[model samples]
Target: MQQPVRIAPSILSADFANLGAEVRAVDAAGADYIHIDVMDGHFVPNLTIGPMVVQALRPHSAKVFDVHLMISPVDNFVTAFAKAGADIITVHPEAGAHTHRTLQLIRSLGKKAGVALNPATPVSVLDYIMDDVDMILVMSVNPGFGGQSFINSQKDKIRAIRQRIDAVTAGTSRVIDLEVDGGINAEMAPVAISAGADVLVAGTATFQGGPEAYADNIRRLRGPLV
Candidate 1:
């Protein structure tokens, strides 16, 4: 059976003072996963939360902790984040020298391994590692910051990755999830979903409004059920 699309609210856009409450609110608001963007100043141009923050929010979240690591030398920190409670750990393909090893490390640590492709990165980078990962994160906007406009060009990228995943895992029950991050809102989400995305990562779109609005926003983004 085809699974329903999942909405992951990025905590980067949440109020830090009451992060726990914000996380719980979004979970209650119907977020399938709590998306955390972990950025190191060197990797992306900004610095954001680290494993400690994820550990703190872990107790408040009953949903999956989808952690996206936008930091350089990601290999050194995979275990730390996993121990801190990341259910799904994603690392950018461009962040390290050994991408496959990093994905394996995340898996070895007992978390779902994911690979992310930057806006400018091609879909072919995932070819060799496709079978090993649980999800592929396509950045529709540049990383580091939230609320940026969606790069509509990524629609084709998402479809291409989805096709590749489908081709490789044809006879197996194992399925690779196609996830789109950046600039996802109620209006843009349907476009991504129609293009074959199984997971939608929304930051500003969820936090721009209050909790109730955030929950309503997720429903609106999902659109009418087929």
Candidate 2:
């Protein structure tokens, strides 16, 4: 049987002042993973959380920390995120020249390695590194900020990457997760799912009305999958 789709709620849209409480509330509401977007102003015109925030929030929930690094010079922060309790660390290949090394570093720290591809980026970049990664993040919108509209053209890209991942790990024990993020709400979710995305990341949709809304929002985004 195929694995059930996973919902990873992004904390970028959560209340920062009450992050620990927010995380706990989401976890209680059945979030599969906690998606954390770490941005550097130089990389995507925004600056957000760092290792300290992650470390402090680590004790609040048992859900996986899906740390997305939208920072250039990505290598310097790999260890910090890993040490901060990120279960899976995803990096944009465009942010650093040595993506292979970055993947290796993440794995060295005993964490799942992931690569995020922007809407304009070709899926070909993942060819050689397919076997090296644990997940492939398909950005449905540009990376810089949250709440952007979904780039509908990415449906084909998600399908192509899923095929590549399956082909590369055909004979191995490896299983790669195909994740879709940005502007993901109840409506756009099925688009990605139909195109073979297994993990959906939602920010504004997930935390919009506070913790009580999380379960309903997640249920809606999940559609019949619940």
Candidate 3:
């Protein structure tokens, strides 16, 4: 069954100086998950928030903190993020040498483990470790920065992963969320949804009109179905 589309407004584009208030605003505006992008300069060319910031933002809302770690040797930091209140921690396959071990660590921490697939990375990466994952993030643009144009090619990847997720769910009770990040706005949102993406990570689109327009932005991203 196709799940209803969910909007996860990325905090990368939120006001840096007032992250707490921004988180509160989005939560009040009806955001499903608080998407937090963590970047390391070595892995993604830009550096963003860390565990402390995540901890700070934790008190602002009761929403799930969907933390995406764009850092290499990712296993070393999974515990910290999980401790800091990340309900879902997403790691890229390229970030660590032992993807399966890394995922196991995240799960062991009592938090949901997610795998993020970059544009060049193949969907087959999930073949061996699908059972260990709770969510699959299909990046529609490169991971380093935000506000990039949507890469239309990724829709194919979304469909492929969607089929794979369905195959897994058919037998077991595993329900993996197919989330699409990068360049997610009102325009490309429906395109991703048609390809079977249930969750969207919107950065600039969610923060463009400031806190007041957050509800409308998220509604637009979710389309008429909501």
Best by TM-score: 3
lDDT of each: 0.89, 0.90, 0.93
TM of each candidate vs. truth = 0.97, 0.97, 0.98
Better of 2 and 3 by TM-score: 3
lDDT by residue for model 1 (137-217), tens: 999998889889999899999989878888877888987888999889888998998888989999888887777688777
Q: Considering lDDT, which of the candidate structures 1 and 2 is the better prediction for this target?
A: 2
Per-residue CA lDDT of model 3 for 187-220, tens digit only, reads 9999999999999999999999998899988889
User: Which residue pairs in candidate 3 have backbone atoms (N, alpha carbon, C) closer than 3 angstroms, thus clashing?
Assistant: none
Error of 1 at 203 (Å): 1.0
Count of residue pairs whose backbone atoms collide, per candidate:
0, 0, 0
Model 3 lowest lDDT segment of ten: 166-175
Order the candidates by lDDT, highest first.
Answer: 3, 2, 1
Off by over 4 Å in 2: none
Candidate 1 RMSD to the real structure: 1.1
